[model samples]
Target: MNERHEHLGRLLTDAATRLGPGPPWLVLGTVPLDRPTAGSDAVAGGDELRRWVRRHVDVWPAPIGIAAEPPELHPDRTVFTPPGRPAGTYYCELHATGSALGAVQVGTLKESPSDGGEVWAIGEGALAWLTIALLRLLTSYAAHATGWGGAGVEARIIPAAGEGPVVPMEVWNHDGGAYGRAGVRRLATAGTARRTVDLASCLSPALTATARPLVLDLLRRFGLSESRHIDPAGVLRRSHFTGHDELIRTWADTIGVPSAP
Candidate 1:
């Protein structure tokens, strides 16, 4: 792998480490396996992609199992596992064929006991970490291919359940520094709101500052208050964000991190 690929891999690893461990998480993507035509640009693209996947696979955490799916599976096809009381899946679907890129879908799912608020928080953290990794990968890819990054890029988080109004948030990319949006389609549901908060926490510091008031405004609109005294880092360390508030808060605040709002 080249320096750019290696650097991106490190960023992904760092984010995963921050998230720690929770329910089994998986990272899946598609890469061309066929050899490229000799003396064609496809050759270079194929090589770059292969190297990138290699680095990512190498650094994947040992605890989280990798989910292997058939290449023919449609990107839009939903994969649901047996419901776990507080389990969820965070996924990022990237479409790339030949030398062109396509639309991306970044989302999360909460299994059984849909009212399980803790699942939403943990799942949102997973989504944010994955989204950041994807952003870094895209940023690097853009830089290497076009000598520029953060062009023609925008992102928004919508309710995974497709049950409510859509809230759109702007996305920015600055050499992979920080940029993204987190919104929800419905506010009436606690699960949806929790996911929305999870998504918002993934924003760049500047964007987060701009988005905070707006997010807080949305919470009030739903008669919901910002969930405080919950330890996001502890959610990473354990299965839920309820206990160990002081320690998690100390570590997060000292580190300038907040769980939601």
Candidate 2:
């Protein structure tokens, strides 16, 4: 139950290569719960997990203006997107031991139908927003450790100590996780004329410069200050940060940060 994320950066890279991508248009993710007591009370059943997801999905995401509404579940777990279309079913698989919670993975059921286009064509804005939302959800549950892989993203978990860093809500707030995707895009466009990044082009490294910081910031805010960045071209950089004061020093050593730190 405690085993998760020992070789993060390299593992993710290899996954993207071998796995290719996650299923099209899926709100998929993993959360490693750090509950101390490994008792039957700690386990989450299907109904509990379904309710948990529904409650959180109501609050997080882009903003109230663009956030996903709570979903209506059918007996088969199919959701309301392009209703009657056999897109996919909702699912939650809990991995836990008697005293401690392992990982909780849920998929394909939290989002609403798109304004238009293919039911599976979830855009970059939704992708970025939901990504942050899922991380926040993990943090809310006091996850010992967590990371995500998208349709084109791959996350490799290197078996590490069952325990993870003492990440608190304060760390997430102070480090600016609340800024979310808007902050990511804003910071990325600081010195350039570009106002947005094309996340769909992720397979091409077209976003190495912008993508690096976005990914690194997620790691930092999640209390994972140490990781190795393996660029699409095969170059690598290892980063470590102990506190906010070292932010600049750390960025200079990160794969990408504003030139001035």
Q: What TM-score does each of the candidates earn? A: 0.32, 0.30
Residues 1-261, model 2: lDDT tens digits: 223332222323322222211232223233332323433234243555446545654543212211122334444221222223222222222233211111111112122222221111112222323333333333333231111122112211111111333111111111233221112111111011101222223223233343444444443433444223324332233221112324323422331222221
Q: Model 2 reaches what TM-score against the true structure?
A: 0.30
Error of 2 at 171 (Å): 29
Q: Which lDDT value does model 2 have at 139?
A: 33
**Runs off by more than 4 Å, candidate 2:** 1-3, 6-23, 26-28, 31-36, 39-43, 60-92, 97-122, 141-261
lDDT of 1: 0.29
Model 1: lowest-lDDT 10 consecutive positions: 190-199
Point to the candidate with the largest lDDT.
1
Alpha-carbon RMSD, each predicted model = 14.2, 17.7
